[model samples]
Target: MKKLNESLEVERIYTVLEERIEQELEERIELGCWMYCKEFCIMYS
Candidate 1:
């Protein structure tokens, strides 16, 4: 029973960490895309 509780807590912590990583990746991808677009516009003009 104690082991099960500990495992549950670990799983919850991992879930939160995974969510944060995904959010950060999404933000980085968006920033990268925006920068690429700006660069393209500058080159085109």
Candidate 2:
């Protein structure tokens, strides 16, 4: 029982960390795209 509980706790923490990493990647991609678009617009107009 103790071992099973420990495994579950580890899994939960891993899942949370994975989710946060994914969220950060998505935010960075969005920011990069926005910056690129702004630069393109300034260059054209």
TM-score of each: 0.94, 0.87
Q: Write the per-residue lDDT of candidate 2 for residues 1-45, one digit (tens) a residue.
A: 999999999999999999999999999999999999999999999
Per-residue lDDT value at 15 in model 1: 100
The whole-model C-alpha lDDT of candidate 1 against the native structure comes to: 1.00
lDDT of 1 by residue, 1-45 (tens): 999999999999999999999999999999999999999999999
